[model samples]
Target chain A: MVLTERAREHARALVRGLKAARIEVVASVPDQWIGLILEEVAKEGSFRSVPVAREEEGIGVCFGAVLGGKGAAMLMQNAGLLSSGTGLVTLHLLHQVPLLLLVSYRGTPGDPLFYHIPKGVRTEPALRALGIPYFLTDAGKDLTAQVCRTWTYARESAGPAALLLTADLFAGEDVYP
Target chain B: MRTSRVAYMQVLADLVVDELVVCGLGASARYWKALRPRPENFYLADSMGQAIPVGLGVALAQPARRVVVLEGDGAVLMNAGCLSTVASTGATNLIVVIFNNDVYEASGGQPLPAAPVDYAGLARASGLALATNLEGADAFRSALQKALKEPGPAFLCLRTAYLPDEPIPAYDMRPLETRLIFMQSLGVSI
Candidate 1:
């Protein structure tokens, strides 16, 4: 019922699913607003966390992980997706590396941060063009179920999949999954 | 005018027998077409500057096997951080060679950062043990021999001219057939 309790449950469920699916590496650039679940999941012994210098590097790192026979995930912000341009289409698209980009969306339509508007508006189109399937999570409870389901799709498709979690999802609502 | 793809493959194939050869994506992977496990095992498509980083992880994880990375000029320009990481970590058994094509051959004939960027200098300044720039197969073979002879992170910058498009075999190494043969060679139980 409480926010913290929901976060704890969702975080555990997400990690459990990642573990069930055999995810071994969590490569990420520190993004505060999204993928708080990953921040918690990373602490477990099975999931090796490799802090990356850039989001593109995270994408590449996950690709390398897959090649090495390990499941991998990446954490970044919505704007960070823009930074992931080269790695996304180049490696994930060309080489067929299965990757998941867990992103935090900063600006939605009519939301704050005017600078984010341009990128926010174009985000969906960009993912489609790259053939990267994306979903949105505006509720904290949706994090685990959506993230796990996306992983299934990513592994099936073997390209990058995404969860563009809204900041309000983590900040606003009181419910947890 | 000087060499064939097989020549490069013969030399590199022997070098990478017990090693992890990270192939930079696009046609650069073609040089490694015949190597055991196929090029895709070591291939990172369009992942410029990714081979070295992945090679570092491989070298660190495997410890016993020497690691070789075949990269491109554009790939190097994209992520020079791999050099810095290799320098700081003191990860030996890693060798990076850039097949400097001077252009992004995969997308379009766009100029690469190679003209403006000095890859050898970048490696040296990153505190690499050895960094050499060379042309031709003989020069490359010599560099390849030396890099394999030693056991510290090093880099070679090879200036290769344009390679015209050819129909490369649809190379994919993740199939069960390939994985079985490759893993058994590594003494891995799959």
Candidate 2:
């Protein structure tokens, strides 16, 4: 999907914020909604952009980066969060490793993808079930703050934290053909 | 013509100096623990098929220190997608060694019915720099030496016979404690 200027700017700011926060690795499995953000993150050149085949693998990759004295973040859609459930619980949650997950809030109302609805509804509940603290946002400014907060909480609690990006955030973006 | 698992590990322990090791849960982890009990060795307790991904991350982060993933055949099969992921990252300082035993020895010797996979061929197809399947200890040792020195996202498949005679010792420390110890050893403040 093509990014709206507003969405592009927002993505840039979030990327810059993550870089400023010293996130050295960005592991991702793309979703159309978060594609621009991941693209922007990849262009920055400061972080090691890892494109993973499975979202769960990103969790392992991110945790490994953290162990190697680097901060890491995972970018994916809500379905990825579901796919990564085991890794999140067994590795990060069980070992108390700090991880930052930037997940797209797919299937939220106003998104007509249809299939994403089920996961969208269950995303928050799943996060809560796993005891992961999360912030849902559509505004870029709020995302910046949420990113900072999530990272802080992850380190402080020695657990994983998440930032959920809503579909409304990219309302004006064009879908890729 | 399968190599003894202990012999393979002994060769690995001798070859793996200053490298961070992620041992997949089950026999591979047990073998690694028995061979090398250092803080640099991370014995994964239960996260199957994740050892390679974790090793990939470490390799990317460090870029200089070699990161080795010692995984079992069953574990690798469960998350074979990791090979593609690891290849995509193209980390030069990474090496994945799969212990191919043809069965899920951990789950009580249940045969893996998913058909046989040629791991070295898969790694080559996945774009790793070096890939080989070794049947003898000498061949494995030689290959491992080259794999260590060469720039790589190297892959090695060591055909192994499962001998369940020795019991894997239970790790007294919690997973977090083990992780902290490993990280702290690397001088990363928890």
Candidate 3:
């Protein structure tokens, strides 16, 4: 599927934000909305991109990266986040390792697919339950700044923080039809 | 005859100096902590099946230092997919040592349903070139030395026997404290 200009721009902004935050390593389990972002990350020279088999494995990777004194982020979808609760709690939260999570907010109101609704409904509550602070991306807001801020907060707090990418940030009219 | 887990750990403790160690949860952590009480040794208190993934991350971030992971058979079975993930990274600085006791020794010696998994074959099939299975402490030590010197993401499975009566010192440090000390040792400011 061809990515819309809007999606491309958003992907670029996300990569730029990761650069601004000095994220040296990224562990990703791909999602449809974040594929372009992953592509951008792979193309970026300064970042080490690790493609993991599972979401929880990505969490462990980020945790180890941070422990090695590198800025790291996990890129995945909300469903992956739901599946990663154990690692997030046992490795990141229990040890207080700073991790920046860039997650696609799938199954939301803007999403046309009915199957995504189940994961969308539980994303925020799951985040809250896990004690992970998160920020939702607004269509009008600057994504780069939002990512940078989230990274900073995770570093300063020495805990995990998430930035959820809403559908409006990447999808155009073509995404619906 | 199966080798003693403690003996293999002692071999590791004696051989490791500058390499970073990531120990799996339960007995692996306890035994490693008791043997190698240092900041470079990151003892996992609760996270089972994540030692290899964490070590892979450390190896990727710090390419100069060797990152060794001490994983149990049960933990490896739980997260066997990590072997593929680690191999895909093509990290030459990581080494995985699985202590295969044929049971979850830490969780009350429950026998693993799939006992005696050929982990070395699994690793080789997963793309790790330097993978071997050893049955004795001397063999493990030799393999570990070779794995450390070679340029590879190596995997070593040591067939070990469980000693329920062996006294392993209790790990008193909290998980947060463990993380801080480990970061400090690595000189990681963040």
Candidate 4:
């Protein structure tokens, strides 16, 4: 997967936002679109990155971090968001722990992969059903500010909030084969 | 003779001090809440199979404080993959103690498939710094004492008896309140 200059910059901005929000721990499950951001997080060194085996496990980790009084986020693809419903409800929602969810909004309009379409379509509805507030990214907008705001909303609400990264944000026109 | 779950927990309550404790859902959590209802103890009343992962997070966040997790056989088997993740982190402050009663004591006394699985072996193979399976009250007390004193990401599996009619007091704290009080106890304001 080739990452475009714009995508790299967006990744950097997202990492900057996380740092600005003082998110100390990030639990992630990789997606092609979010790989650059995860890489940036590693290079940035401001957050502790935990690569989890499953998406639900990431939820548990983030919940624990929040309980310990540190800011936390979960990075994964929209499919992972779909798979993590039970944990989201039982742990974060039931317990009212604040967690920022950074998800690659795959299978959307510009996405080339047909398999991702289902997840893209169901993402918003899933979040709604889970009662998690979300924000969608736009290439024209400042991603750092968007991320910071989403984090703030999560913290203030004392519940999970999601920031969905669109293909445009990642400049994915020719990145995928 | 199989050791009673309460006996093992009694030993733990007597030994544990300032360490943060994460208890898994079901009877184990209910028992812990009754035995030591302290803010330092974070009881997961409903989320099954998540205690270890949460404990790992707490351990990572507070490296200075030891995090001991109380897990049940059924719950651990449900999320056994977390053991590998915990091992990978190599967080020396985390300790997982699995009470293997060979049944889902919380839901009912449903026998976990009759396979004689070695939980300690699984944890060892997963690369934990220390792993041991113990039986009897004497063995668990000594092992737990050693685990507290040692530097390790440890896993201890204790063979316990199934209590069909264990009297577990109702956990009255709401989920949000529990989260807040526990955070307050940890001196974290957010």
- Candidate 3 regions off by >4 Å? none
Query: Residue by residue across B41-97, what tens digits does model 3's lDDT show?
Result: 898888989999999988988999999999998898888888889888899999999
Pairwise TM-score winner, candidates 1 and 2: 2
TM-score, chain B, each candidate: 0.81, 0.94, 0.96, 0.97
Q: Model 4: which residue pairs collide?
A: none
Query: DockQ (Cα-based) per candidate?
Result: 0.17, 0.76, 0.82, 0.78
Which lDDT values do the candidates have, in the order given?
A: 0.67, 0.84, 0.89, 0.89
Q: Give the TM-score of candidate 3.
A: 0.97
lDDT of model 3 at position B24:
91
Candidate 2 residue pairs that clash:
A1-A176
> Which of the two candidates, 1 or 3, achieves a greater TM-score against the reference?
3
What TM-score would each prediction reach against the true structure? 0.72, 0.95, 0.97, 0.97
Model 1 agreement with the true structure over B148-175: per-residue lDDT tens digits = 8887788888777665564444456543
What ranges in model 4 sit over 4 Å off?
Answer: A175-177
Residue-level lDDT tens digits of model 2 in B1-190: 5678888989987888889998888787876787688899887888988899888888888887998889988887788888888877788899899989888877777888768788888788877758888898899999999988988888999999876675656656579788989998888864
Interface RMSD of 2: 1.0
Question: iRMS of candidate 4, one decimal?
Answer: 0.9
Q: Which stretches of candidate 2 lie over 4 Å from their true place?
A: A138-142, A173-177
Q: What TM-score does candidate 1 reach?
A: 0.72
